[model samples]
Target: ITLPLSAPGIAFSLVLVFLLAIGELSVPSFLRYPVLPVLSFTQFAASYNFGAATAAAVPLAALALLGVLIESALLQNRVFTFRSIGRGLLISLGRWNPIAAAIFGLLTVALVIFPLSALFADAFSLTTLHDAMQRAGASIVRSVIYSAIAATILMALGFLLAQLTRDRGQRLVNFLTLALFAIPGTVLSIGLVRLWNSPMTWFIYTTPALLILGYTAQYCAVTTRLSLAGFFLIPKTFDEAARLSGASWTQRLFRIFVPLSNRTLVCAWLAAYILCLRDVPIALMTASPGGDPLPARILTLMANGAPPMIASLCLIMAIASLIPLVILARVIPSRGITG
Candidate 1:
């Protein structure tokens, strides 16, 4: 009973991780693993074969769609409610508590602590970071601006779509975003190039707007999935009561739902922002020449830059992303998001 009840969360994790992995560029590139994303990226960026890139990405997107369909059927989402009246039994980790703690600590050290320790050690001092700022300041500024705008757009889209729960619109949206995410950024960039590179659309393709579009396509799933979980936690009775009291949809959504799930919305936006800010593949493929974002700039610098200078840029990127997220998490009222 408990396992069945946890299906949505489990499925959410699997789907998200699968999509992110499919589109990821760095790990596979570093390991020289000829993954589909990397293959598609090579075709577009290296060979300049937009057709071949599209062909590669389209099949992956299609496979992902099939998986989404399968998930939809197996989950029987139409019958699943976030506000279910029946609760699952809680299983306590009585004897396994120590073992679980050990595993958790090990993962934290390997994934987070060690990597950060190395970056900090290499960066050396304030002077190096200051020099990094001078060199890549414009790229950093563009990254922040571009990511913030994309995040805001996602937050709005997520909230509106989550309100359409159990509807065809929600299902269609889930399918589209998942499919878009599964397609590698380079392939999506190739599509954008073909669609907007002509004389009529040169203004959009030539400017930063194209990068924003690419970010939107790749990261829409982050906020939408988060919003669905967040809004679903709001008891339907709250919305029903508001409706019966003659409150408009907008009024109820803002006055009641928004206030209740404010933190989740903030978190959704933050997640999207971080993904956009640290983005490499999408920016690499779509950014105009000389206007590379921080991540792309870092990739370029790796060719010839000093190790300490590279470390400084990496540290700056971490600080730029971490500080805003930390501030928002602490400052925002966590009244509604219990978990």
Candidate 2:
């Protein structure tokens, strides 16, 4: 009846409100109805129950406290002095310690090369490799497209936002951008789910669009930071020079600012793409039940007791993700690209 009586906006808002209410109500229902009964049953089984769980927790807490105290004592005794530790690490890795240096060099090579090699091997394995490839074939292509679209949207938004704000307001914008860095991916996922879990937002929740949205919200700040840095690097003089040359604002940006910041823009795009590729927590949480990105699929495989397959899948993804990073590293010069 309410659905029929309402307009689109009202109906959508009502549906969201209903879901929020359901989520809110489920908490107390779980605690009072289920949790209390379970607690009572456990208490009866223990027989001497003076809240045995709570009592057991106390000893564990004391042991944790003792460990912390010992750590503090060792730290206070200069066992972890910053300068001394730094000097020791430097000496250990330096040529003065040839064996240590050799060990360190081998470790570094293993760290860098082993993962890629393992992934390459796994990607070619007879049984699992074929299955993972088939599973991820179209989805990998779609994820790349989705990532590119999201990065473009983010770059555009960041540029517009930077252009609209004054120097003083930019500080405030920067603070807000930095603030997002503190929000964990899971928290952002919950917020996205809550915001879009409505009949009207069914498309977002059901499609890969929600994954894109989650990635955008989490990494908008990174895009803003990269673009803003690029923006600053393009001198105010360039804008003035363009204006005096009879170029409009759009022309000035297209011909001057953007051309000058091409490297930064590419770097930003690379950062966004790499982040989107590796983003496991948010992707896992937001992915549609039917379709998931490579990272999420790897995680799902792991959870379903397929370690060898997961390892193989992970190796393939690591290689795939590395291709962009390697390209970006090669393309971006140490010196800035100026118009």
- Candidate 2's residue-wise lDDT over 1-88, tens digit each? 5445434445434543443232221133235543332232234233536355344334333433343343333333111101112222
Q: Give the per-residue lDDT of model 1 (tens digit) for 219-287.
A: 887677777877767778988898899999889878988888767777778888988999888888789
TM-score top scorer: 1
Model 1: ten consecutive residues of lowest lDDT: 77-86
The alpha-carbon lDDT assigned to residue 292 of candidate 2 equals 78
Best by lDDT: 1
Candidate 1 Cα errors over 4 Å, as ranges:
78-96, 164-168, 233-261, 324-335
C-alpha TM-scores of all predictions? 0.82, 0.66
Candidate RMSDs in Å, in order, are 3.8, 16.7
What is the alpha-carbon lDDT of model 2 when measured against the actual structure? 0.60
* Candidate 1: C-alpha lDDT: 0.78
